[model samples]
Target: MDVRFQTGSKRFNYRAAGILIEQDHVLLHKQVDDKYWALPGGRVKLGEQARDTVVREMKEELGYEVHVDHTPWIAENFFHYDGHDYHELGFYCTLISNQSYFQKGPYHGLEGERLIYQWIPINELNEIVVQPEFLTAGLRRVPEHTEHVIVEN
Candidate 1:
């Protein structure tokens, strides 16, 4: 799909993210060409629920099954990056399985390469140059409370 962004035009895109925190560290993927790290999730497919999308993406990307136990942790992040508009939903999930495998995937890296997965501490997010939405809204600490926030365009 071609996303059209006019000058000063505010467009919204729907995407989902999974926050898999283990041992106080979150799982992130490093794009080969970019210094920023991203969470393990993708755009929600048509007719697919957000929770299902997260589960499917985790299985596809990380080669393990995940369980989404609750609603969104962080919601409605508005940000402009690389000349595109993004409004994203970030959810908290628990990693139920321990397994790793490689397969063809999307979100190619700098050299058009697929990323190898890794886990990093939340404190190190700044060093990795993550997406601003994630840096600002997605990483907020909420103890047992999942809250949603809307981002104004």
Candidate 2:
């Protein structure tokens, strides 16, 4: 099972996210009508590799197949949301797509409250809320090798 827990009223999760970039832009998932935006991925299933998790999440969230070159980033995130505390360990991977990937806004994604795909210019990423926050910098100045990050919000 996915790693999760509860402490009093807090909830924690372990997830994997993708960092698909094209033309200096990155794909993001947004909850329509909500002030939240995140990477295009989800929880890593039990016994699933984090890299595979990103691939599976892409298909589930975008209905397209993708390949991962490498897992370039890992995050240990902590935050508070809607009345509960959360701690999420996330894997941020790079995607290599043979098919044309979305490079614009409003691409329909996984079923939810208008959960859609969006491509944000890396330069203008400061305009939205990207969980972990560190991605904001990492994407702009991508490291030569994988980097581990810890985020507490």
Candidate 3:
């Protein structure tokens, strides 16, 4: 995510993310530059619904078609990084696949040069550095007693 910031000012960059949980694990995209992982969603396109963004992002990033369940709006987060501020929404979704779906590919041809997919325990999230919003927002979508939290905020 390329963000520009003004000196001594915070600018909110609008973005969206998705939380994919299965069993006690959550699906995350591991970026190359860092070991930290993130949920499988991206910034919302103009005129696009947040739900649609999750579905589309899954296809583009993971090459799997997904079904977005329930109305989005679990987490809304604001943070500053890389000299800029961000305002993001995290949505919860389910993966729909005709066959076992794993691996990364069919990437939208940008920002995913070394992306890899993995299912990680939710409780272990704190061991790594991730987008805080994704963790906060993602947890709300899962069952209250779930061992793993899906946070997008």
TM-score of every prediction relative to native: 0.67, 0.91, 0.65
Clashes of each: 1, 0, 12
Residue-level lDDT of model 2, residues 28-79, one tens digit each, is 8877776877888888888999889989888877777899888778888889
Tell me how candidate 2 scores on lDDT. Answer: 0.82
Candidate 3 contains a number of clashing pairs equal to: 12
Q: Where's the lowest-lDDT run of ten residues in candidate 2?
A: 104-113
The reply for model 3, stretches above 4 Å from the true place, is 1-9, 71-73, 92-98, 102-112, 133-153
Model 3's alpha-carbon lDDT is 0.58
Of 2 and 3, which scores higher on TM-score?
A: 2
Q: Stretches of candidate 2 above 4 Å error?
A: 110-113
| lDDT (Cα atoms) of all candidates against the true structure | 0.60, 0.82, 0.58
In Å, residue 140's CA in model 1 sits off its true spot by 6.6
Let me know the TM-score candidate 1 reaches against the reference structure: 0.67
With candidate 1 superimposed using the best TM-score fit, by how many Å does residue 12's alpha carbon deviate from the native?
3.4
Relative to the unseen true structure, what is the Cα RMSD of model 1? Answer: 5.4
Lowest lDDT 10-mer window, candidate 1?
101-110
Q: Top lDDT: which candidate number?
A: 2
